[model samples]
Target chain A: MDYVLELQDVSKTYGHGRTAVKANDRVNLQIQPGEIVLIMGPSGSGKTTLLSMAGLLLSTSSGIICVLGEQIDHASASHRAHMRLKTLGFVFQSYNLMESLTAIENVELVMNMAGVRGSRAKERARELLAMLGLGERLDHKPADLSGGEKQRVAIARALANDPPLILADEPTGNLDSKTGQEVMELLCCGLGRDQGRSIVIVTHDHRLRSIADRVLWLEDGQLSETDGNYLPEMT
Target chain B: MFKLAWRNLLHERARLIISVGGVALAVMLILLMAGIFAGSEEHAVAYIKRQPADLWLMQDGVENLHMSSSLLPPQVVEDVRGIAGVYQAVGLLYSTGAVDLGETEVYSYIFAVEKGAPFGGPWDLMEGAGSPGIDEVILDSDLAARYGLGLGDTVDLLGKQLRIAGLSEGTFGIATSITFVNKQTLAGLMGVPPDAASYVLIRPESDADRVQVADRLKEAIPEANLMTREAFVASDQEMIRQMGADVIRAMNSVAYVVGLLVIALTVYTATVERAREYGVLKAIGADTALLMRVVAAQAFISSGFGFLVGIPLAYGIGALITTLLPEMLIVIEPDNLLGQVPVLLAITAAASLLPLGRIIRLDPMTVFKG
Candidate 1:
């Protein structure tokens, strides 16, 4: 398999000297196209740290991180940021939509920064919003939308650049089970399911286990895959 | 984009309206106060500009005719005319007297000039016959209408019966309405006797520099004060500079400080409301330069609205002042206007900087933490 995201012996240390603590200890992982890898770990098991390093939000202390064939661990801040914006899309636990903008404007905000402009950019945003079931709520402000509607708007914003890799950090952590399921289904139902796009989800929710094709267990700064048919040992 | 900036401004129309209104009101008041100060200076120096004298010889230590007393020998005019480059000199007697026309008692200034000099009297006759003949006088239109007096009308001036010879406009000075008469008539009216005049006004034969002439004349008569026409006008303005300047500065300071405060508050509130929005923008790949541009665009929008409202409002205030205070024309000098717009722009630009610094440093990750 041609892996889209690969990490080799990655190590991350939180502090210096006596207070030093290792988050991700020489961990190795690979995610290929059309793969949904769910990262499961107990509290303080370095799952978020690993995801952060993978998403280019945090730097690893040692080892190589390659995303879209670019070595990000040794890259410049702007270079890594560029990679994050072009090749990666983020859906955070909190649906961070700009309250001042309408639903379509929040999505268009991403496209605007991506240097997409004029009528074509606007039409693309409209189509994206319509695809996310937000066509009628384009003019409605965030305060006027429900929890699920806001999350859908955030999802639309994340997909604005048509990036090939999606990194979701507890995307449904704040939602009810039904709404979480709905958002996850919306994310997985289309191109994410059939097309060759990679998805890495950081979650501890057992309910989301059935949707992911593979589940990676992270504990004591190590990772191993578990079968989807059996319950994995916690921590 | 500029369209986004414009829409953001319009979206908060009420708040933006209040902000622009504050700036416009400040601009109007600043222009009006400056006009009043200019008007006062012009009123104080009106006669000095009109006088055709190359030099004025008055009593030693006298600064201006309005603010100082000048005593000189009446024979000084003849002595100054004998100096080289001196063509003709006139002995002028400046004094104040009341003219009583039965129902109205009008205070009038009397300027006594030698009979043959060019600076003999006022100009632009309106309704009367001509220059004051022997024992006659000139009355301005306002004074004439108020006193119901016209040509050949007998007026009691300083206990002597005088006749109205002509009507004119702008014949009033800082003291009161001016009446032109010969030296003999004025000397008799003021009871100064024959030996003394107020000052000697001299005209150079050629267009010689008045400062050189004044110096030479001062050397000839050490007991007298020498002044050029420009110096005389400047001295006259000192009284207005003393009177209206403090008031103008105070008014401008109040308007400027209040305008700055309003701009600061407006920008601060707007930035506070958009803090989360700024974070979202950063997360979406907008850089610091792009964020600053959006903020500057918003300021431009606010200032443009203020300019649209302020410039016209300043003119209207000037017109209203001129109409209500007819004797005064609110003069907005070029320097005063040039200084004000930039001050407003500076306040606006500075106001934006404070909030921009706050917005630029905000991290997008913090928004996710929320």
Candidate 2:
């Protein structure tokens, strides 16, 4: 089966020469359609770096990076942006919604950027926000929304264009335990369905493991598979 | 996308006001400078414009009335009238000098209009008659009001104390004041023949092509210069414009710079403040072009609002200036106001460039850092 995302011998190095630090050293990973992959690691373990590379937000020093079965390691900046908009979505740790825009507008903005406009974009935004249980808070700005609500809005935005892959980095870092569980369940769906959407979440929270189809362990710039219940020592 | 840019601008009321107000001040400065130049242009040509003559005749080689010297022989007026297209012609004695009103002396263009002759006199009068007696002067009523003088008040001209018997309207300007005296009175003081005019005002016959009439008069009086009214007014206006061209250009430059800086600084600051949000947008897959377009749209809206608000403010100040200082005319011409649109647009684009670069180089990866 064609994987939704693939990484082969991808490496990212900061600086050069003697001072160079390898963030992701020859990392390889693959994710299939409708798969939910959770990447858990200690501080500075290169989880964000791996996620950044997969999301096309950062360039890899060497190796192949593919999204939706298309090689994109050498894509132009403009082309990279187009791929991100059309084939991938991102949920940042900070909830990263445009604070100036209302919840519905925040969702509509991504659609508008993707050639969706006017009433069509508006209707899609309303449906997404309503699906995220933010139907009554469409006009609320980011500042006015609660932590869970903001994350929900960010999720709605991530799902706005219904891209095949979603890359989230610590999406529940700022949320309470119960709300974070509820939000992650809504993400993988409490209804137990992904609708053919793949999600790659990087987080330190172990509670998210229940909602993920596969929980992957990332340590020292390398990714490894693990049994669902295992937790590494904090060191 | 445009809505996002607008929302960002409207997010903070205080910042919005400062941004819009800064642009408004710049627009006001640009418009006021242009209005003054246009206003003074009219004032400079007021003398010729107010006359009803279709053509002007003067001494050979003399071009305009202001800063010019012309003395046509007395027979030149008759010679110009003898041409077929010339319906009527009147001789005028003109001089540029100071008119002493007791403790105040006003620089003035003193014209001697022949009694009861058509044209070459005050076109509008506030009081008294268009024709002045030997010992009487027709002066601007606004000038008279400014100095606590009225009709029958005494003003000293050419060392002779004369009464202000006629009050003309629209004769006072920043350049000089125009006052009319009897042709015989000024001729004696000027030591010239009463018939030897500084310039001759000519009227073309009904149904006559003014260009042909001017050509015929020029041919008939080869020793004197003959010009159609349009050319004569343009010539004088050009001379006056050249006089202040350097100063006006410098002022316009300063105003434009101020406007440019105002827009640039505010837009730059706003963009910088919102850089994080911009990075977020980029991270979420917004293209560089769409983001840059947002920045540009915000800048245009800011400057557009300023343009709309500044015009009315300029007009109000112009009216106030006219009421307070009657000698200075501040004319707000539509052409002058509309001309700044392109320059303001250029300024808006230039101002957005700094922010555009910031957006262009912004790393979308930064948004991923917890």
Evaluated at residue B99, the lDDT of candidate 1 is 75
**Please, what are the lDDT tens digits per residue for candidate 2 over residues B1-370?**
7788789888976877887887888788877777777777887688788787888998899999989889988888788778897889999999977889877899888999788888788888889988998888998999888789998899999888999989998889875788899999899889999888999989888889988887888677788888878999989888878898899889988988887888888888888888888888888788888888988888898999889888998898888888898877888888888898999999999998878788888888778766
State residue B276's C-alpha deviation in candidate 1, in Å: 2.2
Which sections of candidate 2 miss by over 4 Å?
A190-193, B81-85, B102-104, B156-161, B205-216
State what share of the real interface contacts each candidate retains.
0.22, 0.75
Could you give candidate 1's per-residue lDDT for residues A1-235 as a string of tens digits? 4478999999999899999999889999998877888988886888878887887767889999998676779887667656766777778787877665788877777777777877876787789778878889989988899888888888888888887788887888888999999888778656466656778888867788878989888888888788755655654
For model 1, the TM-score of its B chain against the native B chain is: 0.77
Docking class of predicted structure 2: medium
Instruction: Tell me each candidate's TM-score.
Output: 0.69, 0.94
Model 2 reproduced share of reference interface contacts: 0.75
The DockQ scores of all candidates, in the order shown, are 0.25, 0.76
Instruction: For residues B105-208, write the lDDT of model 1, one tens digit per residue.
Output: 76776776755556746766687654465677777766776667778888888888888877777764333576776667777777776446788878887867
